[model samples]
Target: MNTQEHAVGQVHRDDISSRMGMWLFLFTELMLFGGMFFLYSVYRFTNAEAFHIAAKELNTLIGCFNTAILLTSSLTMALSITALQKDKKKLSIFFQLLTIILAFGFLVNKYFEWATKFDHGIYPGSDTLLAMESGEILFFGLYYVMTGLHGLHVVIGAALIAVMTRLTAKGIINKDSFVKLESAGLYWHLVDIIWIFLFPLFYLIA
Candidate 1:
């Protein structure tokens, strides 16, 4: 094959490699969260009452709002990909920015929820929390750990999207080259799906 053909073949291989690598990374992330979910199930089974009671303390309204925000963001992320693929560069950038804004809104709401809990002396290692029953304590422990970890993932996903937005704006991630944006969208969707599980588990359990 000619040099240009060889270069094109190498690019194709690299694209496949990038996708495979992203999938493998996503698998590892799922395993991490899946193990946490199993632990939560064991605890919930043993301490159903405490878990239920503790869950009631969570603000379902805020949780639902955040869920809606994330779900909408997922749609925007998908639309962004579609727009890019269709060669609508401006529209794609708009959707990407909108997705980022939605992400920020979700985080803001989450912060307020967490802050309220802290204000009420319900955070990890606090004296008030320590004074609670063992089951209740365990409930709060899992609540903080699980939700906090998920929040971290949201932050990371937003950061990745922000990078993708910048790249898209620069024409680096355009109709002809958008694997990075697609990967970012996949990650953002995963974050949203995880929250869908979390919202019911933590907010609606009560």
Candidate 2:
């Protein structure tokens, strides 16, 4: 076999390894959130009525709206990846920018949602929340912890995408070497998936 062919084969193997490494890291993230979801399940099972009442206080319309925004962002991320694969750099950057904008929108919605909760004194350590039933307190506590963590992820994802956009503009992440964009998309999809689980558990508690 020629030396050049062997070099290409090695590069292909390296790409596979890189992707495998990312999947492993993502698995760890899944387990981290998985444990939180388990705790939420146990508490909800034990305190059904309080959870129900507390969930009713949540703004379902806003929750659904944020879900739509995240889902659309996920689509944009996918399109960005596709554009990169097709060597459409400008289109890729456009979609990446769109995804970042949607991420900001999602955060804005979350801020207002949390603000409304705070106005009602429903925060983690607020006296009002403390006075609520054990089940309701548990619900809000987990709600804040879980969703807050997810929001942090969204922010980080947006930052990563912004960097990817810059790299694409600089020709550092072009079609020949676009694994970074793919990895960012995977992370963004994870963010959206977590919210999908969260939305129903927190807002559809009928």
Candidate 3:
């Protein structure tokens, strides 16, 4: 057999391992967040009124947009991996760039929402919070915590994609492309699923 055939076989094996790892990692993440959800439910039950009011205050439209952005990004990421498997490096780069752009868009929308709220004294520990009714403040506090963590994950995922993009551009990663992209997709999908729940909790609870 020629070198190309050997390379192809190795690449195929790498793809399988990459996919399996992604599934395992996703399962562990689900369990981790499942515990958090359990605690959140306990708080939600005790403060239903406040949680509902807080949900009403958020913009559901924005949440919907972000959800779409994340879902689209994941699709693009998957396409990029497919392109690489076919040895279409340029197309792979294009989709990866598209994914980054979508992630950035989500962050931009979040920035505007967070800044506006901050300007209006709506964040946790603000004077409004200190003097406001009890349950609402707690709801906002949890809101800030969970979304903030999710946003940080977005940043991390984007950074990882950036590294993958560079690696591909310089020809350092070819058949191994699935390894990096799969890990990213796993994390991205997790973030996307979290937002699915968050949107309804923050904007459509009533």
Candidate 4:
């Protein structure tokens, strides 16, 4: 093949390899969260009453608001990808910025909710929390660990999308070469899906 054809072939192979790598990374993330979910289920089963009580302590209103924010962010992320595919770079960047803003809103709400818990001395390993019953303590332990980990994912996903936003603005993630944006969208969606499960388990259990 000619040099030009060889270069094109290499690009295609690289794209495929990048996609496969992202998928593999996502699978590992799923496994990590899946194991945590399994442990949560077991703990919840054993401490159903305590779990219910602890769930009641969580601010459901804030939980619902964060859920809405994340759901909207996911939609915006998808729209960004769609716009990029249609060669609407400006629109794509708009959606990407909107997604990032929504993510920030979600984190802000989560911060306040967690702050309320801390104000009440309800955080994991606190003297107040440790003074509670075994079941209640277990419930709060899982709550802090799981929700905190999910929040970290949110931060990382938002940062990734922000980078994609800049790249898209620079025309690097245009229609012909937007796989990176797609991968970022996939990761963001995974973050949303994980929160969907977490919301019911931690906030709606009551």
Using lDDT, give the best candidate's number: 2
lDDT tens readout by residue for model 3, 1-206: 13333354434554666677888988887777677677678889999887887777788788888888988998898898889989899999999999999999999999988887798799987898778777888788777887887788788888889888998899877865457766776777787888778777776785
Candidate 3: which stretches are off by over 4 Å?
Answer: 1-19
Candidate 1: clashing residue pairs, number: 0
TM accuracy, model 1: 0.93
- Native-vs-model 1 lDDT? 0.90
Per-residue error (Å), model 4, residue 185: 0.1
Any runs in candidate 4 off by more than 4 Å, and if so which? 1-14
Q: Write the per-residue lDDT of candidate 1 for residues 68-177, one digit (tens) a residue.
A: 99999999999999999999999999998999899999989989999999999998899999998878899888888988999999899999998998998888998988
lDDT of 2 by residue, 105-189 (tens): 9999999999999999999889999999999999999999999999999999999999999999999999998888898899999
lDDT of each: 0.90, 0.94, 0.81, 0.92
> Candidate 4 lDDT, tens digit per residue, 1-206?
13333355434445776788999999999999999999999988998998988788999899999999999999999999999999999999999999999999999998999899999999877999988888889988888899999999999999999999999998888999999999999999999999999999999988
Candidate 2 ranges beyond 4 A from true positions: 1-13
Better of 3 and 4 by lDDT: 4
Which ten-residue region of model 4 has the weakest summed lDDT? 1-10
Candidate 4 versus the native: TM-score? 0.93
Instruction: For candidate 3, give the lDDT of residue 14.
Output: 48
Candidate 2 residue 26 Cα shift, in angstroms, is 0.9
